[model samples]
Target: MAESLKDKVALVTGAASGIGLATARALIGAGARAVMADRDAAALERLAGELGDAAIPLVTDLLDPDSCAAMIPDALERAGRIDILHCNAGTYIGGDLTETDPAAIDRMLNLNVNAVMKNVHAVIPHMTGRGSGDIIVTCSVAGHFPVPWEPVYSGSKWAITCFVQTMRRQLNKKGIRVGQVSPGPVISALLADWPEENLRKAKESGSLIEPEEISDAILYMLTRPRNVTIRDMIVLPTNFDI
Candidate 1:
């Protein structure tokens, strides 16, 4: 019964490192062969080596429509049907509404929101044709609660949250399951560039949440019985009040 994932195919985005990497690891552990996509080519190669041949690494630029188009067919050709998709690619830019550069906002939206839409758009035809698949989106706590300093980031995440929620409602009857996982701040490469003050504050507030924490949540959603759809899950650091 647990072998439900065995031999199944999964595609994960932003999978060179951090949360995406951890999720890929978990999926592979559960017996699903996976395609890991990311823009970081060198890192992708290293990860593919570590995971061996069961993990296929595809270099991708999520901001490019053509790149998005190219990835799906390649994965399908190599892995056959895509039984699961983990849309985990995202970007964060910090600035108040007035201080934020318009270009930065555009990049954030295009990378964090539009890219996700493009991937789903490209893959949905196949999923719908099969009449079954799982779409797992990596949303964030900031999606549910506004992070004032980073309005655009919040807005982008909120959009993803709403998209998956509504998609879940529409696809539930068609054997397609949409699941959203919202993560609070976690230790990742993104955190390496954090301002010292903010880093200190995060640590002072609580222990850093690891990528494995979020990965475990994703694994749970993917492994549930066919009839059981875990629609949404929010993972917050123990110290975060929200």
Candidate 2:
């Protein structure tokens, strides 16, 4: 069954590190080439090198309109075609809403929400023309329930959850599957904003999950039968509350 995915091309954003990196590796291990896109050119190049020819590096900042707009084309040029698009690049902003900077909110929203939508919109034509494709977004458990400490971040994910569902409805008829993998307190750079004490506590309590877990879920989503679609998969550690 896994061999059925051989030779497929998966374009993964934020592919330099964290969940994106894990997902890229998973795809490559499954015999698919990975188009790894990220702003961290050094990290991306290094990681791509580690993956050899199966990893195609596309260095572009998702926060930059021009760069983000050109990412799909650049990937197509480098990898030929994209059979899967994983919109997993994002930022996090936590704490009091009154204390959060307006500029920071815009940056987070632009990267977390707008960039995801643009990438999806830009790739629609290519997928439709092919009559088959898979799109998965990295949402959060906070998207399903309000997390007081991360109002802005939660709101961004909430927007994404709705977008993925609606997009799935429209894309399903076109032979394209749209879905989201919502994870809780993943061990990633996204937690850099968390208080050190809380982070330590979560780790001790086994509340944090590794990026590979999320990648595994995404791989399962991709390898499902053509008529099967795991629309919204919520993956979390056993100790995670949400």
Candidate 3:
């Protein structure tokens, strides 16, 4: 199974930490080279160094169109080709819509929606030329359900969920697979902005999933037969309530 990914190159955003970082590690372990892109230069550098030659660190700000556009080309220049793109960089805004700052909403939407579209657009041509590729997005359960705690965030995810589904149908004929992994209440920095009491309760109750668990799901999708596509995977903590 490890040999399945041999010689492939994968670009993963938000690779400095959490699910992105775990996915990058798993890809490397599976014998694929990884280009780790993130806004945190120091952390990206450190993790890439730890992962050694198989990992290349690219510091990127996804909020900027230019930066998002450059990610694919930059990875191609370093790794020669990109076989997988993990669009996993995202921010969370947790609060009632009326009380949430407008700027915060923009930040979340731009990164979650705009940046994802830009990155996917940037990689399509390259993947088309190769005649094969995988595009995995990190969507959330909030996308499928109405979560009152994060209405805007949920909206952003819903958009990507639709985008991924539509793109999958459009690109499957081109030998490119587009899919999403929606995890529930992951124990990552993404939840750092959640209400303190809620987060405390989740942790205490052990209802929060870990980053590595999500990474494993990503690997499963990637390692499947080329004839098979895991379109959408919803991963939740075993003890999670919702």
Candidate 4:
């Protein structure tokens, strides 16, 4: 890392597992305190406890609009300040578009798209006020290319990719940096939503990347000089075709 983040406070959504969890660890490793937010209370508390004082467990359910809205203020109150906001929480729905239930699609969009926008919306004022902050979103390779199998999931990420870019351009003058880390199939709880065939094929073809890799990419983005913003980072497994 080119810069040390010793005094920074980072709020990571979906911090209980997967990329969110990994990013929290990476942030702490770089000397930043982590506000771990997730819906899984037990897992979240357990992980935060293991992370010691630097980790603050915040149980948040992005599914609820009220909770989503409160996340930024709550994190700021707890941490005193937020130097980084990792909007990494998301759900996945795979298979043919028709096979997906409308309710399921709604749930996925609520968490993956709506909650993200709400969180970013909530944090902008605080970050812009400070005249500095880093906002990193967990995007996906599917966002860049239309992956046929997970139409809903891909669509949500595509929305996020656009959101991240537009937000970056909008916030640049405010001295707040906004970017996203887009990864190909990562190994995490979110993978549970993948079709069995796709999951198996991913395993057999070594197409799945570990959460830590994405975290590393995120850390790299954050450590860059304030003047240099990595708008998007696309990480893929060595053998992954997509």
Which candidate has the top score in lDDT?
Answer: 2
State how far residue 211 of model 3 sits from its true place (Å): 0.3
Instruction: Please estimate how well model 2 matches the true structure, expressed as its whole-model Cα lDDT.
Output: 0.94
**How many pairs collide in each candidate, listed in order?**
0, 0, 0, 0
Candidate 4 lDDT for residue 38: 95
Which prediction has more favorable TM-score, 1 or 3? Answer: 3
lDDT of 3 by residue, 46-147 (tens): 887799999999989998878877888899999999999999999999888999999999999999999999999999999999999999999999889989
lDDT digits (tens) for residues 1-242 of candidate 2:
43266999999999999999999999999999999999999998788778999999999899889999999999999888999999999999988899999999999999999999999999999999999999999999989999998899999999999999999999999999999999999888989998677788899999999999999999999999989999999998999865
Candidate 4, position 39, lDDT = 93
What does candidate 1 score in Cα RMSD to the true structure? Answer: 1.5
- Of the two candidates 1 and 2, the one with more favorable TM-score, higher being better, is 2
Q: What tens digits encode model 4's per-residue C-alpha lDDT throughout 75-145?
A: 98999999999999998989999888999999989999999998998898899899999999999999999
TM-score each candidate: 0.95, 0.98, 0.97, 0.98
List per-prediction Cα lDDT, in the order shown: 0.87, 0.94, 0.93, 0.92
| TM-score for predicted model 4 compared with the true structure | 0.98
The residue ranges of model 1 lying beyond 4 angstroms of the native Cα positions read 1-3, 193-195
Worst 10 residues of 2 by lDDT: 1-10
